[model samples]
Target: MATSPTTTGPRAPAGPGKDDRLTPRGKLALSLLCAAQFIIALDFSILNVALPVLGDDLHMRQADLQWAVTAFALPSGGFLLLFGRIADLFGRRRLFIAGLVLFTLASVLATAAWGLAPFLIARALQGLGAAAVVPTGMSLLTTTFPEGPQRNKALAVSGTILSLGYTVGMLLGGVMTDQLGWRSTMALLAAAGGIVAIAAPALLTDSRPTERPKLDIPGAVTVTGGLLCVIYALSTAADQGFGGLDVIATLVVGVLLLAAFVVVELRVAQPLVSLQMLRRPTVAFGNLGGLTTFSMMSSVIFLLTLYLQDVLGLSAFETSLVFAVQGAVLVGTGTAASRIVAALGARTTLVAGLTVQSVFTAALLFLSGDDDVWLAVTALALASVGHMSAVVSYGINATSGLPDNAQGLATGLVTSAQQLGITIGIPVLSAFAASRVGSLERAGEDARTALLGGTRTGVGVDAALVLVSVLLIGFGLRRADRR
Candidate 1:
């Protein structure tokens, strides 16, 4: 259980032979990490702008389109903890580089894909690569920067870049899909990945546990399979109705498997995630709070995109421009969030952000079919601010209390929770909307009328989720501060 020497504290002032003024090497490493984060974040939004184009070009059905998105999300969500533990046992640097390479290759394959199956397979590979990169990068940051101001600042910069990446991705995806084509967007991402891969080897120092533990195979299988099943079921429910037998069965099996995972972790010598860490008020509450906030945020974006295009009749380019407003606010707020957290404390800042977010979410429910565009945009922008602020605060707090060596697992768990929230949120909310729409249709409503009613119902459900998230965050803040 030996820790890296760097985790000890500030080292002696470097002499001429040892230069360390945020050495070129360190800067390069940070750059690679930031680029990796940007690419991963970009993947989340890039497809939004390209989906229509991809569908038209490939003759894809609606179900195929849904799979295109879910294919990436499910694997990324399912494999994070397993890969994070792998990174800890093997080498973070090695895994990070390998992930970069794999992602880049996947992007190339996707660019060349002429069929639905190939494209989806490529996306799944990209997801697997992302699973490796995120945890490894976080682990590297945690190991490189000792706990305190330096680590906090590093996390701040990383978080800001991550948010900015999402904004840039949406804008770029729109422009590229409109002008150059969807395939070109994949090529661009591949190029970015290549750049990261080239820089990673020189900048990242290989590190491994002095005494590595055995791989928790049973825990890994149970958790990964369980999460995959859950995500698959939820995604299925979105496409097929809530009463779909396959969806219900998959969800039931997933729950049971996850319960088995917990039991396995408790009895194993080296658990994939240490149950003891979850006992910590800061870690546990921060995760729950993050889960709630991300779930609402993810579902809101999904519903809003459909509403803007289908209900409001906005074009793709125009819709993307509107989405960019929220991205701008998110980046602006996220940059300053760390300083705000420092000044006000994590609990205060988180609570404030969550409360504001809830207010904005509720406000969206009042938007009528005839509402002004400015009003809708303003509400979305406010929600983005709150979402980004809370996310940054949670990221900082989640890693603060754990011992240095456990930071990778903590980061992975946090990321997994956020993904799980989104995975669960999209299907659940989509199902609510679809059911409501069905009821309205059964009442003899027209298709267009049903869609409008469904969109409103979806918005209402999202607002409710936001309110619940706010309450959970408030509870988490209180619990953490008391500890």
Candidate 2:
């Protein structure tokens, strides 16, 4: 177990009875942390709207376009544990600030990129920065706020910011890409990262590590390579088919490598992830639940964006607006979710949220080209509300049971699971959609008509995925209850 350095020289008299909210300094620090979080969240969804523009400008094929997204997702997904451990071992504030610098530099480079290779490299760099931000931000928040209501409130606010950033990113990316061009969006991201970098040193207090852990180099390499291989295998399967020898071999190797990583962690003196933490009911259930939900959510967003643009004849701006409605619902619900969690225990909230999301997603099956736009938007908003509620509840549960120093590692693990889910889910869903479309086309549908059918099939698959996610959550909750 590890502990953070407590504020040793604190002698300020108690302010009133109990309503001792954040001090002025504490409020500023929270603001800076939220800003960093917003940047990371915004980066995740911002590129979706810009992808087409970037593809056209850079003369990239669809396969290459996927790389632009994967380049960011894969590294960010895989390196979280490694970076989170670094934050805990060295210093949270140090790694946080360093990550900001690296992220900002990457954004600047990406903004200036003229070719696929440079842009992909820059995106990978940005992902590395994001890998640090998620865990470190949570660690800082947990340490800053005392336990009970105040900490819950802070967590709620952080969750809201995370959801809000995704919404704002879609709208902002659309506007930037339409007016200023795709490159300008990256430049704006750089500017935001720079601001965070400058504010970090001033607002964040340094805390020395309680226990310095040795770097698990072999574990890091094994896990990272395994994750990348798995993601690559799934991604390639979308285009090349799962029957390809390359896909099979890559997936096999990835699974073996990941198994090796687990074995290594169990034997290591200072493990990258503390396996003991996974034994906690709340931590384990929350992580698995979060992973399932996020996986379905990411695939839904990807498929829906495609459906909105290709089948519904929506411009990128219009598509972004549609997602914006969902985003707004996510923000509003996420901000209030902690109260809900307090009222209903985490297990109940998790189950309820997952159930609601499942229903909302299933409602999409009723949609068609002739359906009312407002009705579709309503369903999306409902789904968003349920989704954010689930996320915030799970997030609070995942971090609450852990010790302060372990917060980073726990957060990282949860985040890594979610990313891994997305990496695996996307290609599987895409392949299913392709298969459905092919079946329809073989039944005499025209090429254009078949493509439109494919979009609808993709949405259906997304709905099915959400249902499966519901089951996963329910199973995890049941397991927790039994324990």
Candidate 3:
């Protein structure tokens, strides 16, 4: 075979063009990709709700139950950049289809799991599959749609669908877990994954790059390993104190490995992530903004889940309904983000989004068990809208004006930041809540009040982080920086 390896851009028949209208084929392709996003959203929600049931069935201890969530999270977050760059080297469509097959198969295994180990293995496989799909899908979107109205519209549809999927999943997960049993949740993912996997081949085409850069094995190992260690450390700290030997050891290892990754990137010719790319204002600021928004979103969900179910004495389904409000608002705002970006430019839109999120997150500080839980619901709704706005805007702003070759890496950075944010947010913010729990208990407060104090403390921390992102936007969101 000839070695005219190509970077995976769009292999769309229309190619990049002047007009933004999609052919019928394009719409079908977009729908398939968007469906994958929906599956991911649904998968996330269903698993969380089903964990208790799984733990009981498998006879696993409560301590080990976190693995159900962590197993999926670890590889998904850690291997993103690796698979993303691989998508460029091999082929986005090829990797994507392969990933989907793995996801679907893993879902089957998970549903049929007879033991804890098998289920954990299945979750890991599914996470690896997600690692491949998320970045590749975004990369394909950027390539398939011509920038301007076409790309903007496609992204809008994707963002809206993404939020809608989360809401739908939360509601569906509860219903499925309650009525049909937790097994139904895994079955649902398999069905969704199978449908998308089947459509993928017929709808999407792969672009092969001209030159296949040598894989940066060192860079890949160090970075992926580093991220894994980091997330593990935070998780350990959440359960065991941060001062524990395991937590400190993992933190040191993670930092050292990440530093080594930096060194390897500088030395290697075909680095996993380009050093130059890191310096771009859009890349740096965009990823930061994405991380901030996503972490807070995850953190808020973690805090609220405990508060709503435990403190407010709400059912799992009712808690899901409250969160459904946020997800619903995100769908609307996500749909409208394109016009907002058009009018204000991506930078301005991003700043506006960050600001909106800050305001709403801060408002949650006032919430208490005495106050109506609607206060939390309303704040989260507004915050979700703002979060989606920031998500879409930051995506456009980051990927804009990039050479085709770099789009894969760009998307990887965005996706990795998102996963990393979510992974860290829950553990770190949960630790914050846990930290306050002991203190409040010692103060002679009732269990509900103490738990309430801890949850609010976590919410306050999320609010502060959002404000920090606003400061970053102020400094970085400018016309000159977009380049």
Clash counts for all predictions? 0, 0, 6
List all candidate RMSDs to the true structure.
Answer: 3.6, 3.0, 3.0
Give the CA lDDT, 0 to 100, for residue 197 in model 3.
96
Better structure of 1 and 2 per TM-score: 1
RMSD, candidate 2, Å: 3.0
Indicate whether candidate 1 or candidate 2 has the larger lDDT.
Answer: 1
Worst 10 residues of 3 by lDDT: 1-10
TM-score of 2: 0.91
lDDT of each: 0.78, 0.76, 0.83
After best superposition, candidate 2 residue 210: deviation in angstroms? Answer: 2.6
lDDT of 3 by residue, 329-448 (tens): 877787788888777878887888888888888787787787458898988898887888888887887787786667788999988877788778888888888989989999999999
Task: Sort by lDDT, best first.
Answer: 3, 1, 2
Using TM-score as the measure, name the better of candidate 2 and candidate 3: 3
lDDT score for candidate 1 against the true structure: 0.78
Task: At residue 48, give the lDDT of candidate 1.
Answer: 72
In candidate 1, stretches whose alpha carbon ends up further than 4 angstroms from where it belongs are 1-28, 446-449
